[model samples]
Structures are given as structure tokens and as C-alpha cells.
Target: MATTEGDQKLDKSTPEGAWKKLLSAQEYHILREKGTEPAGSGQYNKFYEQGTYVCAGCGTPLYESETKFNSGCGWPAYYDNLPGAVERHEDRAYGMIRTEITCANCGGHLGHVFKGEGFPTPTNERHCVNSVSVKFKPKE
Candidate 1:
């Protein structure tokens, strides 16, 4: 993605320590440490209010409310993201070859993106993101 502090990897080379200092324990775990919130427990799992979702780490606009959908996956699901708002990487964690999504601005771990589940979205993609990894700004 375009060069941005958030686009860089969260590691020792980056200002991870500074980010940790600014984030809560939960936020740090989910965003910086690439952890997942328990399904159905995230604040945004059932939230459908009109808003734009931004990266929790660096406040980068990521997804719009129009793209949000009910995927019955117990997490905030989106059909798409703002262009260049996120970057995808091959995640081999837990022996699964899934695509991991990270904020293009702050490089915080948002969650995974899946496809071919017959979703009725234009892209047929499900961006299952952790609520803690993002913040909502209701359209005014």
C-alpha cells in the first residue's frame, strides 16, 4: 500500500512500543499482537449504525457502513474496505492458509478476509474484522 506509518509492520523496527503505550490491553492484544476476540462478543458484532470504521491504531479510514453486513459469523463483517485502506497477507497461523487483513495506515491486525462462501456482495468477500481493532465514526 501507499507509504504510511500505519502501513508498516508492527514490530521492533516500528514504533510498536509507542503504540502499546497508547493502546489498551485489549486493543494491544488484538491490534498489535494479532489476536482475535471471541466470536459474538465484539462490540460491533451486531452493530449496524451508519458510520465509517477506522483503524483503532492510527485512525485511518477503513470500511464504510454500507459495506457492513450480517454474516452470522459473530464478528463485524464487511463486504469491502476503502481502497488502499488495508493490505492482505498470507496467514499460515494455526496451520491454516488464510488471508490476514491489516490496516494500511497503521499496520494493525484487523482480522481475516474470506471468499467463495456465496455471500451476496459484489466482491463475494467477507472481511471478518475484530471490533476492537476499529473505531466507528457515525456520519453526521
Candidate 2:
């Protein structure tokens, strides 16, 4: 962490307060407060570069680029997540029930999962995620 503001440094090795120190206000809001970014406003919404999408709060690999698809639903849409990388919970906010996905290792909010969408993907699921909650690491 930088003593001077705006000079952010991520100390990813530590799990305690590391995310709070590293994530920006907007990132923290979505990842910690479970806030959602405006539709079609996320950076990863249309991105198709080969990489892995990891939890921005904890650096844990969450989704693979191969699983990504253009669902035209605004936010980044994936057919599946990396096995065991995410945990699902029943989200009952806004009077509707939805499955919320979070980073398994850090408990940071990723987004919601919608199944039975009838997409051509192997898994008929769409993991709607906020770009601020995740970061992309290009394949090596």
C-alpha cells in the first residue's frame, strides 16, 4: 500500500486487508458491497482476448477466456467458471431469487449466474460478472 494516495500497489501475498488496500473505491463497491456496474459499461463486456479472468479482490483465477462468449447481455458473460473457483449463494435482493457467485478463496462478490438460458454452450449457463470485480491476465 502506498502512503501517498493515488499510488496504489497490490500486495497480493497477504489475504488480510490486502484487497481493501489494493482495490479502488469503485472496485471495492462492486466486489465488497455487491454493487453492480451499469449495463454495457464494464471493460470486459466485449473483450475477447485470450486470458484468464481472476478475482480482482484476491487474484484467484475464476474464469477462463475459452469459456467466455458474447451473450449480448452487457456485462462479461461466461458459460462456466473454473472448477471450484467460485461459490454460489441464493441472492434474494430486489424481490427476485438469483444465484450469486463469489470468489471461493476470498469471498469477494463476483456476480450472478443464470442457468437454462438455452445458449449453444456446453453448459446452458451465463455467469454475468462485473468487470470491476475481476481482472484479466493474458495467457502466457
Write candidate 2's Cα lDDT for 15-126 as tens digits. Answer: 4365666679898789878999999999999999999999887677899999999999999999999999999999999999999998887778889999998999999999
**Candidate No. with top TM-score:** 1
Compute the lDDT for candidate 1.
0.89
Name the weakest run of 10 consecutive residues (lDDT summed) in model 1. 1-10
Clashes of 2: 0
The clash count of every prediction, one per candidate, is 4, 0
| Regions more than 4 Å wrong, model 2 | 1-18
**Residue by residue across 55-92, what tens digits does model 1's lDDT show?**
88777789999999999999999999999889999999
Regions of candidate 1 where Cα sits further than 4 Å from its true position: 1-14
Clash pairs for candidate 1: 6-105, 6-106, 6-107, 7-105
